[model samples]
Every structure is written in C-alpha cells, then in structure tokens.
Target: MSDGANLRGRFITFEGGEGVGKSTQIRLLESRLRAAGLDVVVTREPGGSQRAETIREYILGGGARALGPMAEALLFSAARIDHIDSLIRPALQAGKWVLCDRFADSTRAYQGANGKLGDDVMQALEQVTLAGVRPDLTLVLDMPPAIGLQRAASRRAAGAPADRFESEGLGFHARLRKAFHQIANAEPRRCVIVNADRTAPEVGADIFRIVDERLGDAAPAPAITR
Candidate 1:
C-alpha cells in the first residue's frame, strides 16, 4: 500500500430523522461500492460493537430512565468511543471506506434539540468523545417529519414494536428533522442534502453518484452480504 492507498480511507455518514431510510441507503451504497471493488465497511453508531450494542439496547429500550441529560450525553459518548475504537478506527486504518448510518450529528440533534442541552455541550462532547473524528462526507436524507413518522409507523406495525424514541410524538420528530436540516445548513461543506421523499432506488442512485465521484472508479472490496 502506497500513499494513495493510505489516503484512500474515507468516513461517510448518512444522517436523518427516524424513518428517513438511512439504513436502506447505507446498504445500497455499500453494495454499489463493493461491486466497484472498493474496501467498504458499513457500520452504525450506538450499536457498532457488542459493548456499544448493549448500550444501544439500554438506550432504545428506555433503560436510560435514571440518567439525567448530561449523564445521557455521556452514555452516548461512551458508546461512541467504544464504537470508534473497536470498529470505525480499525476499518479505516485498514484502508476501508466506512459508511456509517448515524454519527455525532444525531447526538447534537437529539440531545440538543429535544434535550435542550445546548450546542456548546454537544461540541465539547464531540471534542472529547470523538477526539476530532469527523466524517469526510455526510449525506443527509432530507424529508418532512410528518412523512418520516408515517414511514416509521408503517414499518413498526409490520415489524417489532416501536422503541422509546420511536414512541415520541410528531412534535418531537419534527424537532429532530429541523435539527438535521440545521446541521446541514451549518456545515454545507461537509453535508449534502438528498430528498428522501423519492423512491428508494432513486435516492440510492443519488448517494452512489456522490460516493462514486469522490472515490473515483476504483472497484470496492468484498463484503459479507447481510
């Protein structure tokens, strides 16, 4: 591996409120990149590793009941630290292209918007927890909160019951959507907005085009299809 190979590693994050289909787009993008022969790693925050997954269960299962806002923020950061150390950093050091479903932005959105924790707290948390880990590019799946909530409701009805956050009302979800848009507006250089109201395949193609242009024509490496 030469300098180019070492520099090939990229951290790309997909961001959105619940039901914006970040997971679906991540899968589609990973598949496309793999077909093109690039070493791609797909992972998510709050549950990228066993330990983090445990924390994720706690958070989503409403186990964070006793935790105050600051404590809750710390818990999320703790999971993120473990996720970065155990998964994200290793994959990137191996020269793999990483696709993350959600990342620090979600914290700023949920904690800041809903918790009303303030941006300074979120920024400081990012500094200490992530140690300056920032995505090379962030694709924001933009959609109205009402539509997103409907999608989530339909999916939940078809699948398992709604999680704690999923049980939040439309107003809460609307705040989350606003937070995501605010984040993109605040950091245009690193974020690109994709209208997710379109069909899945169309949205997937938009994501692939952005990634393809950035990663160039290199073929992606093999991945264990899920």
Candidate 2:
C-alpha cells in the first residue's frame, strides 16, 4: 500500500436517494480494497470529521430543515470544508483510498435540483467547498423511490425515527432520484449508475469489477503472505 509514498489516493463516492444501500455498498467496497492491500479510509458527507459530525447532528436532527434549503446547503458546505481539510485530504495525501458514502453530489441533488436553489448558487458553493478536489469515481445507486423508501422505513422500524431527509414526501425522493440520474449523465466519466435493487453480494460484485476495471493500475499490489 505504501509502495508509492507520493502517489495520491483515489476518491470514490456512493450516491443515491434514501435507502439505496450506499452504506452497505461502501462497506463491501472497503473490504475488497483492503483485502487487495490498499489502505482505505471510509467516510461520509454531512459528517466525516469531528466538526462536520456536529453539523450533521444538527442538520439531520431537523434543526436546519425549517431554515429552508439555502441554509441547509450552506451548513452542508461548511461541514464539507471541515471534512475535506480535517480528514479526507490528509488520508488521500497519504495514499489511502477514500470511500465516501455521499459528497457534494448530495448537495447538488437535494439542495440545488430538488430544493430549487438554482445552478448559480450550487456552482458557487461547489467551487468554495470543494476547491479542486472531486471524486474520481461516483457510484450512483439507482432504484425506485417507493421501494427505497419502504426499505428505509424498515431500517428505521426499530424505534428509530427518520431523519430530516428520510422524512420527506415520496415526491421529494422521486425528484431526488431524477436529480442523481441527471448528475450521472452530466459527468459520465466520473459517475456510474448501478442498479441497487439487487442483493448485496450481487451489487458488491459489480462494484468491485467496476473498480478493478477503472482503477486497477492505481490499486496497490496485494500483500504477500506465506
């Protein structure tokens, strides 16, 4: 993994509407990459570093929803700035692949497209928050909104309440799905839309194959064992 100290690590982000199995896919990919002798750092947006997590709690806990999408977008960007500086950039600089559950694309989808914030504001926020850092690959997990919401509800059935985004109406999620597809279409080189309605193992296999095909050269040599 450390064969090339100067080599910058790859950044991959998983994106989707509610309950699209992003967390599960991220875990699966992390395991595969680690087994292949790559140093992997798994993180998530709205919260990755400490300060960002605090922002995450506030935003998801419904504190920012009432303030409108613009406020939420700003908060998300603030968290992202901290996340990039505190955790993500450092890990990548050390040659560790960063698998993020969500990133700026979420803001683009939820706030810009669905929230009706317009492209100008979204572009400005993206410029400020991301600087020059962008994901090398983004796996947009595509699935029906109704089915995804059902899965989300099931996951939250253990006496856990839905978060701000999760509590949105079905129409909101439908638009969110469309927004993600639009993003994938706009940046085909950096984004791949994966059908996420299948089983975890099946989805994992496809994701691994995509990673190997697209980034095999950058991956570290598997560790030798006796």
Name the runs in model 1 displaced over 4 angstroms. Answer: 1-8, 157-159, 215-226
Query: Which pairs, if any, clash in model 2?
Result: none
Quote the lDDT for 30 in model 1: 80
TM-score of 1: 0.89
What TM-score, over all chains together, does every model reach?
0.89, 0.94
Query: In angstroms, how far off is 43's CA in candidate 2?
Result: 0.5
lDDT of each: 0.82, 0.90
| After superposition, candidate 2 runs with Cα above 4 Å error | 1-7, 222-226
Residue-wise lDDT of candidate 2 within 200-224, one digit each (tens)?
A: 9999888988888778777667532
Cα error, candidate 2, residue 174 (Å): 0.4
Q: Model 1: per-residue lDDT, tens digit, 124-210?
A: 898888775678889999899888878988877566778877788889888888888899999988898899999999998788777
Candidate 2 to truth, TM: 0.94
Residue 4 miss distance in model 1 (angstroms):
17
Q: What's the CA error at residue 47 for candidate 1, in Å?
A: 0.9
